[model samples]
Target: MPNAPAADQRRLLDVQALDTRLDQLAHRRRTLPELARIAELESQLADLHTALVTSQTAVADLRRELAKAEADVQQVRDRAARNQARLDAGQGSAKDLQALQHELESLAKRQGDLEEVELEVMERLEAHEAALAEVTAAHTQLVDGKVQVESERDAAFAQIDAEVAGVQSERATAAAGLDAGLTALYDRLRGQLGGQGAAALRGRRCEGCRLELNPLDLDAIKAKPEDAVVRCEECGRILVLLPEDH
Candidate 1:
């Protein structure tokens, strides 16, 4: 058995209380609601970014298609206009003039067909542009939401950190000047038993495990000298005996 001054044994209980508070604070930090919300927002942003890129690419490809269609229509119009001007000037023999008239008719038909293709490409391009705009707006909204959430999360972190620092200072003070051998034993047991190295023995109960000691065990513990360190059989934790009036 280990020995410690009874006063040091009582002070161990104070250290245990402070240590438990620190553990609780750490757990709170890990499980904060802001952390979960941030993760969810990040996932949504990733998927939205992919969609935004796809919309932009589609709009660019359609704009290039429309440009080609417009060029094709303009080329046919220019050719038809030149043919009509030559026919009006009457600068060729009858056979040549008749051939010119026939060629002008063919060019007019070609221009109409090219115009139809250009109209179709323009319509497709307009629809894609609208789609791209809508996607861009949605992406911007989500980005703003993420920034707001991040700010809130940062504020929460600052509050929790301040509390943790305060608790750590108190724990250090509580553990100071404690018996070296008892402190070592307590630290070792805490590492082994879920952050709880010592608990009070109230009446016939072992507070560490919340179990009632058998009469024989209770009497044996009571018979031990006050300075003799005692452990509970139920939980193997150091048990500090309190005064009856306490």
Candidate 2:
């Protein structure tokens, strides 16, 4: 029902093209591969960190166990040594000497048992330490990988953002000074019609919906003045009638 210069109606196609490109750019930003990859890497890093912490805790507990085992062995050994020295001085009765000898035997056996416990704890501590070292190294490698991927992701973001900026500027220029009513109608239709407000009528086809206009509709559209605005019956989009060379 509105009117615009024939040239302005055709220029609206260029504006539509720019808008479509902008939409594509926005979709590209949302579906960037780096975003998914980064999320995956972060999840792996979180699991690896938990494993590393668990390994470290096991090593710490083993170390404490080894220390207590060593203290127990040393205490038994010190007591046996003092008992031997007193027995050698021969300053007590036979009963006392006999009792001291029996006690020496008990102390020697206690020392042997304690030494076995110490050795077992030492072996366990060594194994846990080795496991901790392996986990630490793996965690460090994962962290490095995450950092590298993050850098790549940032570079990708910068590139896409720059392209979006360029496309937006072009769109602004293309839409500038367009017929106010036409532009307003186009925007409202675009909001309702999946980002396409206008499309060309090539032959009988409405490019917006990819459907052919009926002969009656096509004839009616063709009868309109060159400056008269028309909409496609199939899609409800402004139909720009470009001049056919043939």
Candidate 3:
């Protein structure tokens, strides 16, 4: 059997591997592209809603103006009819009759002006209605896009979570099989080494820092006992040697 220190070193390496995988899963969850797209869609939707409200308000104001103008025209016509009846009944002096006729002519002109204003208001209402329709269409498209993106994002997160859960379960099992003292040492070293407590030495290189070992360091590691755990001088990471066959 390997010495206690060598066994602890192996367990630390396994823990490091699991930690790396956890970091990757966390990064994937945090930086999803679909989430950014969803934020953009929501902003556009809010702008569309504001534009729609403004356009509808304009339409309502135009309608109100048109109704008021039509009412004023009807009132002027009624006044003119009353003046005509008074003239036919011979109830006014000649000068008064002339004044009434002049007033009737002025009222007719005013009615024409009101009708022109009403027409202009109706044109504006039509333009606002057209703009509202366009905004509504755009809003609908964005809503549909948001729905699709949300569904895809949810599914992606769910899959990532499932993978993380499975890996965590396996890591727990591995931990259970390790010696208690070894596990404690690994946990302490992991905290001290910025989450990476162990590393593999491949081809005279430290995998953690990707740095090649100096001649002296190589000689020192070579002279160490087989079951004597050793650390990389440069990176302070437990360095595992390759098997004899590979």
- In the predicted model 3, the residue pairs found to clash are none
What lDDT tens digits, residue by residue, belong to model 1 across residues 1-246? 989998899999999998999899889889888789878988988998898899889889888988988888888788878878888999799888898899988988888888888898889889888988998898888888889988998888899899999988998998899999999999999999999999999988988999999989889888888898999998999999986713
Query: Which whole-number lDDT from 0 to 100 does residue 84 have in model 2?
Result: 89
| Backbone clash tally (model 2) | 0
- 136-211 per-residue lDDT for model 3 (tens digits): 8888899999999999999999999999998898788666666565566556767888777778888789998899
Once model 1 is optimally superposed onto the true structure by TM-score, how far is the C-alpha of residue 5 displaced, in angstroms?
2.1
lDDT of 2 at 24: 89
lDDT of 2 by residue, 1-246 (tens): 899877888889998998898898788878888788878878988998898889889888888888899889889888888888989998599898889899999999999998998998889888888988988898888788878888887888899889988988988888888889888888898999999999999999989999998888888888889888898887899999988811
- Alpha-carbon TM-score of each model against the true structure: 0.88, 0.88, 0.78
How well does candidate 3 match the true structure in TM-score terms? 0.78
Superposed model 2: Cα runs more than 4 Å off = 88-94
CA lDDT of every candidate: 0.89, 0.87, 0.79
- Lowest summed lDDT window (length 10), candidate 3: 1-10
Sorted on lDDT, best first, the list reads 1, 2, 3
Better of 1 and 3 by lDDT: 1
